[model samples]
Target chain A: MKDRVTTPLGAVTLLLLLVAVGLGLSSPLDVNQGSLVRLMFVHVPTAWVSYLAYGGTGLFGLLYLITRKRRWDRLAMASGELGVLFTVATIVGGMLWAKPTWGTYWVWDARLTTTALSLVVYGGYLLIRAMIDDPERRARVSAVVGIVGTLYVPINYMAVEWWRGVHQTQTLKLLGKVRFDAAPIYGWVLLIATAAFTLLYIYLLRVRGIVAARDEAREERELMNDLQGDLNSLTPQGGLRG
Target chain B: MDKYAVYVIVVYVVTLLLLGAYLVWLAQRLRATRNEAGLTEQVRATSTPGNQTSSRQTPGKRG
Candidate 1:
């Protein structure tokens, strides 16, 4: 059992994360924000990974609908679960950083509000899935939820611009003209941290998929056992089922 | 730096704890399932009428 748990991907992720942390420490601090800026290494990437995980959930959900495959559903479910985890991380990181800078743990900033809303939507997706016992029906119902819940992601992203919220505007943009507004060293460290966290999300997704697949298999086995028991009860002691 | 050290430590530590907990739990779960499935396979093999040899050396055969 000890030997059975090897994970090359996980090991790599850990190493990369260590490197990211080292870079973060060595990088210069913000002139105004000071050492508190180091929190961005975790904060920014956690938010990005949350968004990525939710997008993965919606993508897999769409594929499940199109192909009617359990694999897609399992991936979608894992993605949604991890999406929630990362979002929680984002919130925690944000709060921790906010206390030092904003002098408060929370504010009614539009970005924060929308991110919280998206969290609730995905949380409901998991809750709804748990309520349905039928595997096919559970997948079908949650696939719709997963797909629709992710519609909030874009809104969450645009919240800063749309509402002109207190949260800082996007300083690192991937599309359109590339933007890296921070110090070059900090930018590189942030990039590495982002890449590391993204990989971490993917590795966790794979691990969680195994859990989902095993659960499905166990349910199928239990259903089969029930059917076998029913058959045994129907047949005579010395007959076919016996 | 020392003034805000607690916040940085908390964020990094909490993130690590959360991640490590989930990963460890997943590994334990997968190992438990693998062992359970193996046990079930061995039971089924040994219980079948003609698997006397397998029954006698089920652990050995698997190893």
Candidate 2:
């Protein structure tokens, strides 16, 4: 029996689904956007989670640099992978929403473009990890990329305001009088959706990080055994080196 | 269903599909890793002290 305990990720995922459907069906639609407002429940949460994932990747990468621990590297890589997936979701959801609202399936708005660039850069970060076989070197390189790639997250958020893009400003902003300007039910749905997605991200991070750590440990053991076998073969006698 | 309703449904559907697929992929990886660990444990058990030399000698006869 080796680490046979079940993970809570699936359980949390089921809960998220129930909450998502509940909100989707019951939340009030926007006056202008009509039923199309329902897309916000999924779109906004995915976008927020994508940013959270990149932020986690950067934070874990910094921790790895400070502590020189393989666990930190594993966490950073897991977050990066999740960030890429969430970004894809965000992009797809946005396009779907935009097609009906903006009358276009694609746009080159500042926010959209910057978000796409963020996806590409972070995606490169994952590719960097895959290209490097040496764990230590891979961690070092990915940590650098992870930290730098996260700079795009803030830029993506601010792109609309700074550059006068077609993509509207965030409904939820940190500064400027905490206002969502939507129905209270819409706000509640968005809040619950955000929490659910955030929980989902954290759960995935934990499970993915554990799996990554185990695989790395297993690989390390195999490598050590191979080295021992080689040493035994090269030795004058059939014994380990003193 | 309205056209906008269809768009919203598609978006949610795609989101669910992508995330669901990711979870499934992670589950598969975890299962495979567990199986590998179990196989490794069985191999270690079989190659106990008494059979270590014989197990090492027959490189082709792996568990």
Candidate 3:
């Protein structure tokens, strides 16, 4: 099972996805929102998984800072990339959900605004990673950004309660009462979708982590070759011939 | 289908397609990297220290 998990997490993710679809379609519609409530299953899970990915990015970033290990940096980058992907999904999903339910595709609601900011901040974090070619320098700078950028997560989560908005309050509150109400079947389906999305994130992260390591190694090799050429060119036999 | 159903289905399709594309891309890259690693190891094993000068030359632009 462990070997299968390591080599074929994507397959496992696909298997789990069957559960998401089955549960989502089998569940009944919301009383108020009608079929529009179906969007909740996809939107909420993508949004939640994006949080999980960003949180992992921050955690790995912190670990990299403490240990000064390249693996942790790679993991952080992998998670951050997944975070950006899911954040895009969340924004798109939210927009679709918003258009039907809220009568508009977007609004200045605190939740929507903060969530957009969260996406932008993490997107910029990736830009920072790309701009710096030196791996260690990139990791160190991105670690700082990764750790600091997570502050937006909580602010985004709390935005609904902090200010009035068209966006509804969170389904699962960190504090205070949980205001979410739906059929037990719907709740279960949403949970399954969340779990499936999280698995997908993990699968993608592993693939990304491997690719990142290989890319970094290739860069190092090329840089070494360049430096070696420079060194050889400086030698008496080579320099005089040049 | 209803308008709301269309929205939901489209959202799901978009999510699945985006993720599926990423997975396919990643799998290709992983395969390429594995092949590159094997080739690198073969070169390292065959090359001798004395032959370093010949190997030091950069490949042609077509490479």
Candidate 4:
């Protein structure tokens, strides 16, 4: 049974996914949205994962600055990359859900607007990394960018409440505050789905971080080889002397 | 099917497709990195004098 899992975290993710599907698809429909409410299971969770991913990027970026660890910086980059992917998922999923509910694909509502900003900000975060050549300099500069770029997260969270937009308010809030306009099973499905998405994030982060580290190592090795080849050509013995 | 079922299905299908594509890409990248790193190690190991490997090919570009 254990071997069925690719990784322990992956196993948990798969299990939670199964539970979420079992409950989410079978749960009673929303009074207002009907079967369309099923989309919430995917939309809400992907949005939440985007939050967690960006938050992880900021946290790891800060840690990289403080500890000066290469792995931390690599993990930060991995998280940012994943954040972009999930953010795109969130936006598209929300837009699809919106069309059925609100009869439109998108609006300039506060939450939606800030979400669009999130795509820009995190997208810029990735773009800046590619423009810098030195890894150390890139890590330092992007660590600062990563940290500051996430300032919009809290604002994004509070947008609906503060600005009163067409977008709905958060389903779950901090400090034991919870709101569910649907059946209890719907809530359960949501909880499981969110957990499943969170676990999936962790699993992907682990795999991506390993790949990122190896890529960085390979890049550095290539750079070293280039430098060595140049030195060999400069020697007095056909290298170094020049 | 309900009137809005198509919308629901579209969202799920698109989301799943995007996620599956990302996972596949990640898996391919991991394989590429492993192969590239292995070649780098092999090159370094054989670079010792009198132990030169015939192939002096540089590692190929990665995604």
Q: Each candidate: fraction of true contacts kept? A: 0.49, 0.69, 0.59, 0.67
Which pairs of residues have clashing backbones in candidate 3? none
Candidate 1 C-alpha RMSD relative to the actual structure: 4.1
Candidate 3 regions exceeding 4 Å error are A1-4, A177-180, A239-242, B1-3, B49-63
For model 1, which pairs clash?
A: none
Number of the top candidate by DockQ? Answer: 2
| Winner by lDDT between candidate 3 and candidate 1 | 1
For model 1, residues A110-211, the per-residue Cα lDDT tens digits are 999998988899999999999999999999999998989889888998888889967998878665798888888888899999999998998889888887
Query: How well does chain B match by TM-score in each candidate?
Result: 0.64, 0.71, 0.59, 0.63
Ranking by TM-score: 1, 2, 4, 3
Tens-digit lDDT track for model 4 on A1-242?
A: 22233477777887887777666666677777899889889989998898888898899999999999999999999999988899999998888888878989999999999999999999999999999989999999999999998787888888888999798877776535566765677788888889888888888888899799888997898799899998898787876645
Candidate 1 chain A: worst 10 consecutive residues by lDDT?
Answer: A1-10
Q: lDDT of model 4 at residue A93?
A: 86
Error of 4 at A203 (Å): 1.1
Clash counts for the predictions, in order: 0, 0, 0, 6
* Per-model DockQ against the true two-chain complex: 0.49, 0.63, 0.52, 0.57
Q: Give the distance in Å from residue A73's predicted Cα in candidate 1 to where it truly belongs.
A: 0.8
For candidate 1, give the lDDT of residue A111.
94
